[model samples]
Structure formats: structure tokens, C-alpha cells
Target: MTHQEPPRGRRIPGIALRHRWISSVMVAVAQLIGTNGAARNQSGRVHLDALAYVLLLAGPALLPLRHRLPVLVAAGTTTVAAVYLALGYPYGPVFLSVIVAFFTAIGAGHRRAVLIIAGTVYTVEQLLVGHWLYRWLPPAGDGPTSWMTTSGIAAWLLAVLAGAELFRSRSERVARERRERAEAESRRAGEERLRIARELHDVLAHSISVINVQAGVALALMDEHPEQARTALTTIKAASKEALGEVRQVLSTLRAPGDAPRSPAPGLDRLPELAEQAAGAGLKVDLSTVGARFPLPPGADLAAFRIIQEALTNIVRHSASRTARVRLGYGPEGVELSVDDDGPSSPRAEPAVSGGNGLVGMRERAAALGGTVEAGPRPDGGFRVLAKLPTGAAGTVAVATEEEGR
Candidate 1:
């Protein structure tokens, strides 16, 4: 939902100065000509003169200030209109100014004031002027106004009030809808930012960890064993190439929103590649699965792959043990993955295992799909990471993409 911005002004722009001034002048002209025309036909009523013209113009002249001072303008217009009626002048378009003022006041959120002013005017016109003072008033021999006329005037006032209230309510509703839409857009932007951050962290952290380890090996062996150093170089090339590809895929979403990914996200199908990379880093990864394999949603598939990848990367960089174990279990409800290294954890790995973006990113990925990740030191040795992710139906998970701002 959307709303047009109201014109900016010192006061409520619903009754802008230009519009009020123009309307007031137009009303004054209309009342002058209309009252004269009506007076010609109703010969018994008091004829239009200088005093009557002043009163007719006076009510409309105050309309320009209604927004800034709603209660004062409403009361002033009502009082002037009541006085015009009491003096026995022929009634014509003089009521127009009163209508404009009352409507403006109510629309400006001064309904109570307008109501009180209108009610008082109605009472005075019906009781004092129409009934009691009609005899002494200018129209000689004029009798008290009939109850039917008073009832009609009362009904007219009520109708004006009702119409003004409706317009005010509709304006408020439009403003509210605009606010909700803005908040939704802001929330979407925030989610998109977090998704990009999380994806970048997972992608770079794992591949860089592999690259860092291989580079160290290549440097250590370059002089003593060129062949082994060359093999390490090859592993480094492969790891860097894979990392660049994944980074490109994740960033591609920013360029094209709501479009299918250039390549499918890696799933358990890439476990062999992960194991091979671990081997090059001198950490053997053992992969095993339980339960029948079934198709998983894209969000859950991507999350599981990243989790296992991060776990293996941590084992290669932080664990003293040479072997790491990865287990995947599929059930009717969800998918569970576990990565563990058996040995004492390296001193440098303590802070990472205890508190780092790797574990945080893994948990974020899993939680986005209503899953969970738990990582801690093993009882007798190294560290372990376990994640449980739900395999939801297609389109069920509303994962935020890198192109969220779009």
C-alpha cells in the first residue's frame, strides 16, 4: 500500500492556505449573488444591505486559518452563520462557509471541537433565533420556524460530521499502510545483508583454510623435495579455483535477483572433493552415510554442504589428529551431519573452536532452515561439529539471497 505525500506546510496541509483563500473568496461571491436573488423572491425577509454583506463575507474570510486554528475558526464561522440567521436575512449560499470550516476542522483532527461548535450553532439557531426572537427580528410578522425545518437542519449537520469523519479515517488508514510497507522493505534489506555476510564467510573461510595449509607445505618442501612441493602447488591451484567459483556464484545473485543460480549449490555429492582436499592438506577425511538418500530442498542442501566443508576445514587447521570422520544421516524428518577429529586440539585452535565465525556461520546457516549446529571439544581429544538440518519441501523455506535489496 502507498499514499501520496501531503503538501508540506506550517500547519495541516489538508486545508492549505491557497485552497482556503480561493474557496473563501469563491464562497463570498456566491453568497452575495445568491442571497440577493433569494431576497428578491422572498419580499418579506430583510433585504441584502451593507451589514448583511459584511456578515456573509466575514464567515468565509476566516476559513484560511482553519488548519492552524481549527477550533477558533470553526467557532467563529458557526457564530457568524448563527448571527446571520438571527437577523432574518434571506438564507442562500451563506451556509457554504460554515460547511467548509467544519469540514476543515474535522479533517485536521479537531472533530470534538467542530462537533461542539456545530451543536451550539444548531441549538442557538433553533431555540433562540428561530423560535423566541423571530417576532422581534427584521422580517415583520414572521412566526416561529416549524419543528420540521429545525429537524432538517439538525440532520444536515449530522451528515456533514459523518462525511468528515469518514475522510479522516481513510487518510489515517493510508498513512498506516505506508508505514507498514516501509518497515517490510527495511526488514528485507537487513535479511539480505546478513545472508551475503554469512555466505561470504562460509565460502572464504573454508577455501582459504585449505589454501593456507597447502601453501605452508609447498614452502617447507620446495628446496628439499620439488616434486612434493609441485603436488602441493597443484592442490593450492585447485582449492583457489574452487573458492573463486563459489565466490562468483554467491556474488552473482547481487547482479541478478530472483534468477536461478548459474550452477546448482553443492550438496553431499561434493563430499569426495572435500575428502580429496583434506588429503592434500595431510588430514584424511572419512565420509559415511546412514539411512536411504532422498532429495533435499535447495536451502537445506546448500546449508549442509557448507557446514561439513567448514567442519573439515577446522579439522585440517586446528586438530592435531591426521584423520577426520564425517557422518551423514537421512530420516523422514531431516538430515544430520557430524564431523569429528580424534586427538588433542592444537593450542592455536582453542579460540576458534570456542568462539569464531566458522561455528557462528554454521549455526546461522542451519537455523535459517530451522536446523541446529553444535561444536565443542571431544571428551578425550580434538573437536567435533554436528549439524541437523530439515529437508523442507520446495519453496517452503524463504531463504534470503544475496540480491535481497532488490
Candidate 2:
């Protein structure tokens, strides 16, 4: 149906014009051989002459252009075949070439056109050739064709169109399936890229915020407070080192899939390290645990850790408050995390950078795990981020690990 390229299994299993040429020549030769053989029995019919040969071969001659112009070729071939039959030449393999043209036309999505032409051509043959003009033609004394013979020919025409229509439906279905598969693969690829991007942003945003604060401290105290300046430089070195190590951990999974991670992903158990890091950046973070503690599923563990990490990083970058609070609660089906910072947003720090994913990233991480995140300014003059992550799914960790490898 598509004009962009020659279709497969239309006329034949090929797209090149040369294949059409070969097929046309083969059909012409077969028709010539079979018609000559049929002439031995049908001596009452018109004799084969030069014009008879030309008209007999005309249908196959037009076969080469069927893919590009099927409707015209189908109509032309059916007309030529009808004329050959009307001349009262013994009917044998003379219909072969036109049959090939009919299939080609139908396959190229011109079934309606081909069916109309074929029906019209058959009507003319039955009227003038088989009934009305047989006496005037060279096949003298020939009367109208028998009712049985007319019915059989009509059935044959129906069979050809029906067979072509069936094949067309099958090819259309296969094409549709292939398109769906391609679209699915494209969608999966996009999701994988976004997941990896979120991982990188979560890993870098916190450490970078720490490094920035420490860098400012070291610059201001270089001369007057050399001892404090040294402490600030030490914190910078530690933060950069940890950032690089975690970045390598993420990249290693990419280079070698299905292998053990160089180190396990950080979980909420590492909250003390976060507190120490916040303290180094001059923010006193208080951590609390509620309900009972249990090892969370890997998906929930990673999501909970990142949500809290991002919340703390946001406080360090956006909130003027010197103290932040974090509460982790474990329920039977899921874990809840709440991070809070007191006071209005910082003029010295910065807003969640112009186009950055801060709270949005937290929400995405939670939603991926069949959970939700809610963040807003509290009525008590502070900002709070709350997330709930379900841990009931099996193999959540393996799926996340495999995606990073890709």
C-alpha cells in the first residue's frame, strides 16, 4: 500500500523491479506453451495469428509496473484478457497473466478498483462473446455458453479476489504488530535515561551543596582563623571524595551488568553520616526513629534515603535555619519519611535552582515505588517534605539494578 518502497509478498516476495521482469517473462512463456497445447483440442475456435499472440501476451507485459501503478495495470490486463477471450481463441492458460495482475493490484490496496474492473470485464465477455456476438466472430456456429460454464467462471473470479483479500489482511496485521514493538522499545529507553539521570542528580546535589558551604567557610577564615580554615578544607576533601566514590559506584554498574555492586546503595541506616555531614556544613540535624525498625525492601530503602538526602540538601541550600529535623517511621506495609526545616527561606542560600529537580525528584522516586510525596511550607513557619514508599513488591531491587546496568 505504501509507495515509499515496493511491498513484500504483494505480487511476489521481493521489492526490486528485476524480480517483476523475471516473473512477467515466466508467466508469458507458460501462457504461450499452454495455449499452444490447448489449440489441439479446440479446433472450432479462432486460429492463432500474429495479432492473437500480441493480445495474449499483453497482460503479462504490463506486470512489471504493477507495484507503482497497480490500478491502471489491473484494469488494462483484465480488458486485454477479456478481448482475447472474445476473439474466440480457445480459453486455456491465457488468463494466467491477468490473474497475477489481479493479485498485485489487490495487494497494493486497490481491491475495490480491481474488483470493479474484473466484474465489468467478465460481464462484457458473457454478454457479447459468450452470448450475442459469437456468430459474427471467427468461431462460427458457436452458440451461447452453457449456464454451468458461466457459473463456474463467475465463481473462479470470486475465489481470486477473496484469496487476495485474505492475504492483504494478514500482512496489515503483521505490520501493525511490528510498529507496536518498536514504539514500546523506544518508550523503555526513555525511562531508563531518566532513571539514571535522577540517580546522578541525587548523588551530586548533596555533596556539592556541602562543598559549596565549606568552600565559602575556608575562603572567609584563611588569614584570621587558619585552624578553622584547615577544618573547612578537610570537610571539602571528604565530601568530594565521597561524591566521587558514589559516582564510581553508579558508573561501575553500567560498565559491567549482572555483577555485584562495588558497594551497597545507601539506606536510611546511614542517617548518622548525613547528620555529621550537615553538622560540618553548620546545620545541626536531629534524627528520630518511630515504630519498629526492619530492613526495608531495596526499592523503598533507596527511595527513602534519597528523599531524606534531597530534603537535607534543600535545607542546606535554601533554608536560613541552622537546625533541621528528620523523622523515619516504619509501618507494616510501608515506611514514612518527614524532613522539616524551621524559619523562612534563605536570601543568602538560594531558591531550588531555576530549573532543578529538588522536591520534584523526591516525588518521582516515591511514585516509582507505588508511593507519594507531599511538600509545602508548614503553618509553623518552616518547610516540610513527607513521603510514603510501599515495600510489598518482590524483586524491586533487582529491577532497579538491572536498569542501571543498561
Candidate 3:
């Protein structure tokens, strides 16, 4: 789906200048033969006939320049032939130059001019050869068969013209479609980069800010509450480390040349770790699972993880609730993840310090996976976050608890 420009001065394979040269030589020979025979019959002398044939052959050399200056070449050759006709000379192969010119005009996207010139030249040639001049100096034929012969020549010329028009139209349409497709792809890539940038800013910024606050709290309490300070320091270290990993993962997408690429991204299997981390940050995160244990797509996993992480962070910072629940359920059609906190449920504007990037990032992620997400307060005095993602197949598996008859 990519186009590479060819090197300068390199000719395309089928359209080489050599083919034009060969065609010009062949057409010249054909003109020589046609004129030689016709002039001999018309003038009844060998010397004068040879001169006419030479003049006709001279016209065909113009064909080699048709690709560069099609209209000029056609006009010049046709002018020469028109003069020859006035002198009562024979029909010549130089007429082929008009066909070559029409072909070039069509290919070069000048169809209107090509049609006008083709119609004028063809009409003039028909009038001169078919009726007017034929009555005065007709070819050696006794029947209507001569008329058929002349008509056939005109039809063949028109057919070549039609073929050239078809080729040019199709080529132009294909080129237009290719350009449109490339533009669409460019727009999609730009949108994707913007989405990635927003996610990195939302996720890493929020995590690092939390880590910084915890570190500051630990420092402030070190001399007073040793045990509490130790816990705060531990949470600070863990948050900072996780922030570094998230930042590195985001930055890894922009790895420079010569850097070894990282492993494939995480998926749903890491959701439990995310819940555990939220619990460590002084939130009681209860985890639950339902249905199958089938593998989830990488995109689905990352989206689910980010959704849970944001929901927990919101609960930690905004709600007075100490307990949050994370739920995962796989079913016959799709997978679903939901987080709920039985905390202060009164609706309020999102914290000014963090903005609303978390909600935007979550919506963007879900949309990319062809999934759905909803975040709102429940009727039962709690906040809720829910997401549903389609799975390729339905599956079944055993579910286990941390201490099941151990």
C-alpha cells in the first residue's frame, strides 16, 4: 500500500522511448509504401511519385515527439498531409501520426482537446478521401466495396481513440482512489498518536503525583510517627516504582534506533496486581471473578487495567469510602469489568487538580476496542464504573479462591 518513486532518468518498462522510435520507423515505412503505389497511379511517372513518397515519409518522423508535444506533432503532420492532398498526391501512412497524437492527449489528461482535434481531423480526412477527392481521383475499384474500405479505416481510427480514452479514465480513477486511501490512513495515524499521548499524560502524571505526595508525607512524619512514617515511605517507594514502570512503558513506544524492543503488552491477567496495589494504597479493594479463564486480547487487558486504576485513584482521592470492589466476568458473548465504591456518593465536579483526563482516556480506550464504558453514581449511595468487551470465543473454566479448602 506504499508508493516508492522511481530513480531519476529511469524509464518505465513498457513505456520506453525505444518503443516509440520503433513505431515511428514502422509507420514511416508503411507511409512510403502507400504513397509510392498511389502517386504512381495518380501522376503516372516514377520520379515525381518517388518525391511524393519521400515527403509523406518525412511526416511520420513527427510521431516520435507525440508524447512530448502531441497536439503540435499532430497539427504539423496533418498540415503536411493536407498540402499533399491539395497537390492531388496519394494517401500516406503519416495519417498514423494523428492516432499517436490522440493517444498521447488522452494519456496526458487532455481529453477535451483530443476529442476536438480528433473529430476535426477525422471529418476532414473523410470528406477529402471518401467523397470530394474520391470523385476526382478515385482508387481502382468498380463497386461499393471501396466505400466499405474507407469506412473501415475510419472505424479503426475511432476505435483506437476510444481505447485510449478508456485507459486514461481508468488510470485516473485508480490514482484518485489511491490518494484518498493514503489521506485516510494519515488521518488515522495522527489520531492514534494523539490518543497515546493523552493516555501517557493522564496515567503517568496521576501516578507520579500520588507518589510525590506520599513521599512528602513520609518525610514530614519521620521524626514523629515512626511506624506510620515507615508505611508511608513504603507506599511512596511502591508508587514511585510503579510510576517509573508506567512512564518507561509509555516512553518505550518511542524507542530510538538501535534500542532493543520490549515484550508484548500486558492484558487481563494483571488486573489482580492492580487491585492489590490499590489495596496497598489504604483502600480496601475486594476482587471477584466469574465464568471462564480464557485469555484476553492485549488491548482489552490494557484498557481494563487502566479503567480499574483510574476508578481506584478517584475513590482514594475523592470519596470517603474505605472499601472498593473490582469484578471481572466472562460470558458466552464477551468480558465485563466493573468497579464500585460504597463511599460518599453525592455527585461533585471532578477534582480541579487532576482535570478530567482519566474519564476521557477511559472512554477513548474502550472505544478503540469496540467496547463500552459507563461511570456514574449508583442509586444505592456509591460510585460505579463498568466496561464490556467482546471476545472472539465463548469459554468455560474452573474458578478458585485464595483459600479454598487449603
Most TM-score-accurate candidate: 2
Worst 10 residues of 1 by lDDT: 394-403
Q: Judging by TM-score, tell me the better candidate of 1 and 2.
A: 2
C-alpha lDDT of candidate 3 relative to the true structure = 0.70
lDDT of 2 by residue, 1-406 (tens): 8668545435534547788899999999998889999998988888899888998789899989888899998888888888888888877888887788888888879988998998898888876577777778767777888878889999998998888888788878888888888789898767767776788898899999999999999999999999999999999999999999999988886788579888999998888998999899989999898865667877788889999999999899989899999998766566788999996788997745554687778888898889999988898789999998887633355345545778
Q: TM-scores across all candidates?
A: 0.79, 0.80, 0.70
Rank all candidate structures by their lDDT, best first, as comma-separated numbers.
Answer: 2, 1, 3
Residues 1-406, candidate 3: write the lDDT tens digits. 9999888647786677789889988888877776566555654322445556656766777888888887777677766665555445554454665666666778887777776766676666566555665444433441222567668866877797798898888878997898888899899878868766865765675576466556666887889998888988787777778777766776776675246536445566766666666666557888898865666666677777777787787786677787999898877556888999997832432454443777777888888788888988899888999988875543222223212424
TM-score computed on alpha carbons, candidate 1: 0.79
Candidate 1 local distance difference test against the native: 0.83
Q: Could you give candidate 1's per-residue lDDT for residues 1-406 as a string of tens digits? A: 8987655433565555678788778988888888888778877778888889999999888887877888898899889988888888887878888888877778789988888888888888897788897888877889999999999988888998998899888878988888898899899988888888888887788788888888988999999999999999999999899989988988998889799889988887888988898898888988898866766777788888889988888887778888999998876567889998896766655455456788888999999889899988778767889898977642232222212434
lDDT, candidates in the order shown:
0.83, 0.85, 0.70
Model 2 lDDT at residue 402: 46
Per-residue lDDT of 197 in model 2: 78
